[model samples]
Target: MKILIIEDEIQLVQSISEYLQTENYTCEYALTYRQAVHKVLKHNYDCILLDLMLPGGDGMQILEEMKRLKKMDGVIIISARGAFEDKISGLQIGADDYLSKPFHLPELAARIYSVVRRRNFGNSNIIDENELQINLLAKTATINNVELSLTKKEFDLLLYFISNRNCVISKNALAEHLSGDIAGMLDNYDYIYAHIKNLKKKLNDAGCRNYLKTIYGSGYKWEI
Candidate 1:
């Protein structure tokens, strides 16, 4: 999953990004309100960690803009404003959850997980797509009840595809989702090709149909 962290605190952003990375989440950050707006306009994230007090504008304003854009990305207000009214306002605006500052990293992660789950999978941890079954808790994908031995990256890629099934996902999106921050620095996408190839082989070898398709110069799609 991918997250956008909109906060001006440099240290907090770094710490949160690193912790989320450890949980296999791709993170992008914006330090200013303008940057945050630009990012939200340009890309799709599974969740957004928004701070209310921003450099140029209030985070509530950003929430308004997001609502106007009709974006469905899950949002969690991670602000120092811990008042009951602040929490109520955020939830009323569209935030899925509110996390006061000085909070535990694990708790933040759990909240993000819950929000993303509610948004993407209707709060279900398991995904059943025809003969393919994925247990999000176990991080396992099985075909006809036979488990496939997949690497972490491979499993993540599978989930990404499954979640966005029937949509043509660009290679750039896949690369960023896999490499996270380093994706911006890398010039080559050979790694993506290699992983996709391996994932395709594994699934096809396990008596699964080739649901994954390449769209010529566009990208790949899961058309099942």
Candidate 2:
């Protein structure tokens, strides 16, 4: 899954990004409110770690904008402001959870896991799509009880396709999703094709049906 850490404190943002990256999550950073708002509006994320205070503006404004724009990105408020009113206001504005500062990294990871599970996987750690079964916590995929030897990127690709099943996903979208914002500016997307090819081959080798489909000039789709 992907996470966005919106924090003004450079040290805090770095710490969060490093920790989350170790937890098998692709993370993007926003050090100021402008960057935060731009990322929130531009891309989709599994979860966002938002700080109430920012360099250019209040983090609450970011949440309000997300609400106004009807973005469904899961948000977790990570801030020094621990008052009940702040929590209520954030939740009312569409935050999925609140985590006060001076908390353990494991707790934050747990909160992210819960929010992402609820938002993307229907609150379940296990996803069952016919003969294919994926365990989110374990980060494993099995087809007909046989585990497929997949790289982390391939597994992430498979999960991304499943999450947006039956929808035509553009190459630009896939590149951004897997490679973060920088990939969006790049001209080439051949790396995405490589990942998809490897994922499909592994799935086919495991005796699974060919659910991965190419949309020709458009993109790719998981036609379940």
Candidate 3:
């Protein structure tokens, strides 16, 4: 899933970005409110980690703008202000969850997962797509009651595709989702080809029809 972190603390931002990257989440950062607004208006994200106090402008203003745009982006407010009123105001303004500063990274990750699960995955632990079944919590996949041993990237790739089924996904977008922000520095998207090829082979071998299609000269599409 794609996450935007609107935090001002450099060290905290880096640490959170690194941790989420390890968890297979694509992260983008904005240290100031202006940057945050720009990103929110420009791109779509699964969730946003927003800090209440920010330089240039209050983070709540950014949230208000997001709502004005009618964006369905999920937001989790992270602030040093733990007052009851602050939490209430955030929720009243449409924040999905609130996290106080000095919180555990694991806890934050869990909350983010919960919010995304509720918003995108119907708050279910398992996602079913035709003959394919995925245990989101366990991070496992089965087709026709047969399990496939997949690498971490392979599993994540499959999950992303299935979650966005019938949508055309560019190669760059796929790489960014799978590899995070640093994917841009890569010399080539050759690894994407390798992963897609391997995933297709595995699924086909497991008696699943190849649902992945190469949108020649553009990207890929996973359709029924």
Candidate 4:
């Protein structure tokens, strides 16, 4: 899954990014309040790790902006221990969870996965949709009990589709989600097309149903 880290501590950001990378999550960063506001407005992520104290502005304002935009990305407020008021206020403003500093990486991973799964997986580690089965923890997919050989990008693409099934997802969103870089850094969406092509081929060849649909002028959809 894609994660956005809004933290001013460069060391903490690096540590979180490195550890989450090991857990198969693509992470992006915003070290200042301005950067956080920009990303929360423009980009999309499965989960956002938001720190309440920022370099330029209060992080609560960022959450307010997210609410203003009606953005649905799950947010987890990261604050110092004993800041119960901040935690309560953050949850009231729509943060899905809260974590204090000096936390364990494993706990952080579990909390992040919990928030993402609540948004997409419906409280299960496995997604069983008729003939198709996906193991979120394992990052694996299967059709009729036969495992499909998929690249990491391909697996992420499949999960993205299934998670937001029946919605038309634009090429720009797909590109940014799959890429570690920001939206402006992308040259074009040709790489997205390639990934979809390979993903379709693998699914089709594996005797899976053709649920992937291209929306002609808009984007792609999993039209289950």
Judging by lDDT against the true structure, name the best candidate: 1
Full-model lDDT, candidate 2: 0.84
Instruction: Give TM-scores for every candidate, taking all chains together and pairing residue i with residue i.
Output: 0.57, 0.56, 0.57, 0.56
For model 1, how does the per-residue alpha-carbon lDDT over 1-224 read when each residue is reduced to its tens digit?
A: 99999999999999889878866789999999999999998999999999999999999998988998899899999999887899999999899999888665555765787688777876367878888888887889999999999999999888777655566677877876677557779988889999999999999999888899989987888887
Rank order (by TM-score, best first): 3, 1, 2, 4
Residue ranges of candidate 1 with Cα displaced over 4 Å:
127-224
The per-residue C-alpha lDDT of model 2 at residue 212 equals 91
lDDT of 4: 0.84
Comparing 1 with 4 on TM-score, the higher-scoring candidate is 1
- The TM-score that candidate 3 achieves is 0.57
In model 4, which runs have C-alpha deviations exceeding 4 angstroms? 123-224
Predicted candidate 3 versus true structure: per-residue lDDT over 128-156, tens digit per residue: 77788888877889998888899999997
State the lDDT of candidate 2 residue by residue for 184-212, as single tens digits.
48889898888898899899999999999
Q: Give residue 207's lDDT in candidate 4 (0 to 100).
A: 90
lDDT at 87, model 4: 85
Model 2 lowest lDDT segment of ten: 102-111
**Which portions of model 3 show Cα errors greater than 4 Å?**
123-224
User: Compared to the true structure, candidate 1 yields what TM-score?
Assistant: 0.57
- For model 3, give the 10-residue run with minimal summed lDDT: 102-111
Clash number for each model: 0, 0, 0, 0
Of 1 and 2, which scores higher on lDDT? Answer: 1
In candidate 4, what residue range of length 10 has the lowest lDDT sum?
A: 175-184
